[model samples]
Target: MSCIGNCIDHACIKSFHSMIKRELVYLEKFKTREQAIRRIFEYIEVWYNRERIHSSKGIMSEYENL
Candidate 1:
C-alpha cells in the first residue's frame, strides 16, 4: 500500500507540474478555473494516458499495450 501511494504521489505531482508548466503557466492569458480543470482532465485522460506515446512505456501509451 505504501509503495502504491508513493508511486501514485510521484506520478501525480510530476505530471501535474509538467502539464501546468507546459500549458497554463506558460500561457499568456489566464483561463477560467473551470476551463483549466476541464482541459487538464482532457489532457490526462485522453492524451497523456491514451494517445501520447511514452518512452518509459516503450514508446506506447498505457492504453495501447494494456
Candidate 2:
C-alpha cells in the first residue's frame, strides 16, 4: 500500500510498517530528521532482522508438512 498504486501489493511491508509505527515511532520523539532516519535504520538493520524472532522462519527456511 505504501508503494506505487500500479505496483504489486505486498502484505509483508504493511505488516512491517505497522510494527515499526507501534514499537518505534510511537515511543520516540525525534528532534531532527537525521536522528529519526538513523534510529529507524538501526531499528530494522540491527534489532529487528537480527534479534527479532520471526514467525515465518520455519515456513520459509524449512517447510515440511505431514
Q: What TM-score would every model get versus the actual structure?
A: 0.43, 0.63
TM-score of model 1 relative to the true fold?
0.43
Cα error, candidate 2, residue 33 (Å): 0.3
Cα error, candidate 2, residue 18 (Å): 0.2
For residues 1-66, what per-residue lDDT tens digits would candidate 1 score against the true structure? 356647765876798788767865577354697876787777667766674446566685556679
Q: What is the C-alpha lDDT of each candidate?
A: 0.67, 0.81
**Any residue pairs clashing in model 1, and if so which?**
none
Clashes of 1: 0
Q: Which consecutive 10 residues in model 2 have the weakest lDDT in total? A: 57-66
Q: Indicate which candidate wins on lDDT.
A: 2
**What local lDDT score does residue 11 receive in model 1, on the 0 to 100 scale?**
78
Quick one: best TM-score, which candidate? 2
